[model samples]
Target: MADLFVAGGIVTALEDAAVAVGRLDAALAGNPLRRAWTFWSELDAARRHAGADGRKVDLFRLAAHLHGLPLRLGDTASAPERGREIAGLNYAIELRSWMAAPDREQQRLRDIALDSLRDCGGGQPALVATAQGMLEWLAGQGSRPAIRAAVPLYLRDRGITIHRLAAVTGGDSLRAGPVDPDGFTVRFLETVGREAAEGRDLLLTMEREWRQARLRVDHRAGARSNSRLPAAVDLLAASPLLSISALAEALGCSVEGASRMLEALVQLEVAAEVTGRTGRGARRLYGLKRLLPIRAETTAVQRRARGGPRGRPKRVLIAPFAELADDAGVADATPDAEPAEPTRLTAASFDFDALDRLIAAADERTRGVRRLLDRIARGDKPFPTADGTEEPGAA
Candidate 1:
């Protein structure tokens, strides 16, 4: 009876896994951001597996590093440690790539797996034999860690390349445990179902966000026919990050125009600048606010404290003087419109709260300076003069 119940559970699990895989595959079909989605999914898998091995890899930094962006000061990982982690992540990503390779390459990999299994005196089923052989080959390469890490990759690859299921990693289920083929198969199928469902949900959320962003952009520019806005939205969705120049090139527009469009999206709350810095020459990056998990490296308050303006300073204009009426009615008689709102000075604007904080911070240093001066006055220490010589009356 126990054996029969286990068999029933396996059947149920397999059905659920098939349903989830179908849903995920449907979502990926014709997805405009499919490449971006796959890249993020692979990165997420790498993150999870790295975490299992007691390493915390920041997804945002890894993405930025992969894209050749400059790392912020907060990324304090030592060079060797960062390199090792990145190499592992690259290998994990490569495994996914291999799983998605062309039919010929996949055939080659399958042949290798089968040959290894035959050499190991295979009597298991085909799928189980292939997986065991893959592990055995990895072990022969002296990669115990890879043997463990590759379990999910091998299962995902088998599903994608052989079973025509969605590419879904099983890391969430393949925890450390005694090796039991039946138990492992149950867990692996269960994880595939769960991960496929999650991937489908994520894709749905991204699509929803994309549509909402487009609607917001259209609503903000009512009746103006801003054709580039939707394109911008699509571009932002497909790329992890974009700079003004990149956007301009993509949209076939001027840099200033692209900047203006980005600001408009930001104003409409559709997009967000992920880069924390706004100083001159700072590399600014922007992305869809809802789709991306990355936030600005610094917040608005933090940027203000750092004396970096959030954007270009507002231009101040000098009000023109009222012209004196000419004797012969030569002055224009058109009525002037209501005076426009005054443009505030960006550079000279004062923040009294920040000023107070600065003064408070300086108090300790001020007291220390005063104590040193008092000690010099009492000859407890020699006082240096402006000429870098000790005062004559000092000790």
Candidate 2:
């Protein structure tokens, strides 16, 4: 009875999985950002698989590593170990060369698995046979993760891919969870369906953003009628990052021309140089400004100092100042008054004693107010009244 129920559930799950995958496939077909989407999908897969194996991979650094750029300084301590793991993940997720010619690598991994199995001695023929069948099934499938996980060649290998495959195939009976095959099938199918739906939504969003960006670029490129500019924008949109030489080669233009084009785009604020370098001679890398992380401080234009000259103005003395003062003195002086002791403003003449007392009183009042506020905040005292006494009828 239980077996019958399990089989029925799997049938339903298979239909859902198929539909989800089909939608994702349709979304990917002939998209202008297909390459970019493929790269993102592979990175996501690598991150998931690595997480399953208890390893954390930084997607940004992985992107940089794949782009052949040197890892930034602080990462050098764990460089070797992290580098090896990244290389493995890269090999696992890489599709271009694999899709071109997969037989060689597949054969190599198969031989490794077989050799390992043989050394263990043919004790459980059923288990060995099952493993062999999995390897063959893996070869027939186009999924890279499934193939990598089906083979037990790595010491830290966890068969996550095979479990996912089992979920998708529905016919392959693999224990996906501790409960039962039926529960595992249902759970995995649900998870895959959800992921596919989410991926499709993300793809749509990326496409929308890409299209808007392209239109903005086109509008900015207006009437000058430069065909290469739009093509270059498309290339940058599809690429993770590109150097001048690479862009030149792709556009079939001179390196200088590519440099000028990138500069123009940067100025237009549609593209940015990502290397965080300012020198003309630095090895600069460029990417779509909206899609990649750009150091704003490095790329922002330096603002010139505002207001007047940079330093104090030179002092100027008026030539007729003494004559003008004498004239004013004659006009204002009284005829009989014993030239009033030229009113002088000396430090000792002015009385600051009263002002000093006022300032001291003010300081004391400020300190008292601060203390009162602190006490109120701490709930040690009641709110004060208009006259600075505790409120009437208050606790």
Candidate 3:
């Protein structure tokens, strides 16, 4: 709450500065306007207090810089684009820095923020905040119900619906409460791991009916499946190229099954299908393709605006050791540089192409579970016994 208060204060301060600058610009343009320097004075005072790493302070500075740029340019034709460019640049860099921090879930959630920003076309601040909140929650979570509840609130605030959130997080409201928190986290981790492993989305679903004023579930899919797919998706995620047969072979399913899986992914509006399907049983390929590049660009730009590394090692430096010191006995010992850290892919570096593949896998999994549940509910398929034997279907 204190953090939120501080964040809000920063925004209000920036808005005030922008307003003052607008008046100043008008006066310079010979348009009559009221004078106001209070904002400027307050901003200066805030800057002095902000010290370093106060992102809000930086935002205000950028806002001031941009407010004056349009006035100086005169021909306002490109002002909107310039403003958007500035915002994107700052967001990308800051987000990247945040992802590189010590916490792993924070990094993962930041990736979710970047992808959400891509879809929303540059509005990711809320997503960032929500993700931060959720990650903080995850680190200290103790109860299954609490964890499940927290995820929905965070995702919903970030503009994701219950179903979409479920598709991404693989949490089923019906079973979320009774499950183990550690196991739940593992399931989520596994789902993402499988996604990383095979380049596919993790998905979960369940069926429910009301009985005597209470909602009762008729069928369910457990959390164990969530972690399995990420492993599967990771294997397929690397290929910039894909084919139906290749996917089918990877998924261990028939060509028709793979095709259906791909189709379901397309319906979720997550994965992109590459054009050119072959006739006479030809295989189709898919990629993690998103329609807009602005989000990706914005992420990159934010990193630059923040004046920090975007987490990916751009280059490696190497040097040779001149002398070996066994016990500090050798003089002028030059340190031999170790190999550069292997570049780990962050959410910022993910090709939307790979993300789409995960989304595809998630879709396929959702459909499979739905079909099985539907068949069971309708008496078309038999229920399995405790010993794993299926009973005969209803007549």
lDDT of each: 0.53, 0.48, 0.32
lDDT of 2 by residue, 1-395 (tens): 12222256466765665467556656665455545555455545455555544555555554554443445434455768855765554543342222112345555654555444344423322222323344344345534344433332221123222212211221123323434434654555555565555556555655554455556767876886755676666666665566776677766689899999887777766676765554565557787764343322122222222563543222233210112221366557676553221221122312233223323432343344334444755887455666766663321
Which residue pairs does candidate 2 place in steric collision? none
> Whole-model lDDT, candidate 3?
0.32
* Deviation (Å) of 116 in candidate 3: 24
| TM-score result, candidate 3 | 0.20
Return whichever of 1 and 2 wins on TM-score: 1
Q: Could you arrange the candidates by lDDT from highest to lowest? A: 1, 2, 3
How large an RMSD does model 1 have?
Answer: 22.3
Off by over 4 Å in 2: 1-6, 73-103, 107-176, 278-281, 294-395
RMSD in angstroms, candidate 3? 27.7
Per-residue lDDT of model 3, residues 1-395, tens digit only: 12332243234433432243233222223111000111122222223222222323232222223112111122454878666544443332233222112135544554554443344323334423333333445454432223332442344455533222221222221223325433443334333222221111110000000010011011121344432232223323333234566566665667776666555544443344443333644334454332112112111212221465564222122111012122453344454542122222233322344334544553343334334444655886445556645443310
Model 1 TM-score, all chains together: 0.57
Weakest lDDT window of 10 consecutive positions for candidate 2: 162-171
Compute each candidate's TM-score over C-alphas. Answer: 0.57, 0.52, 0.20
When sorted by TM-score, best at the front, the candidate numbers are 1, 2, 3
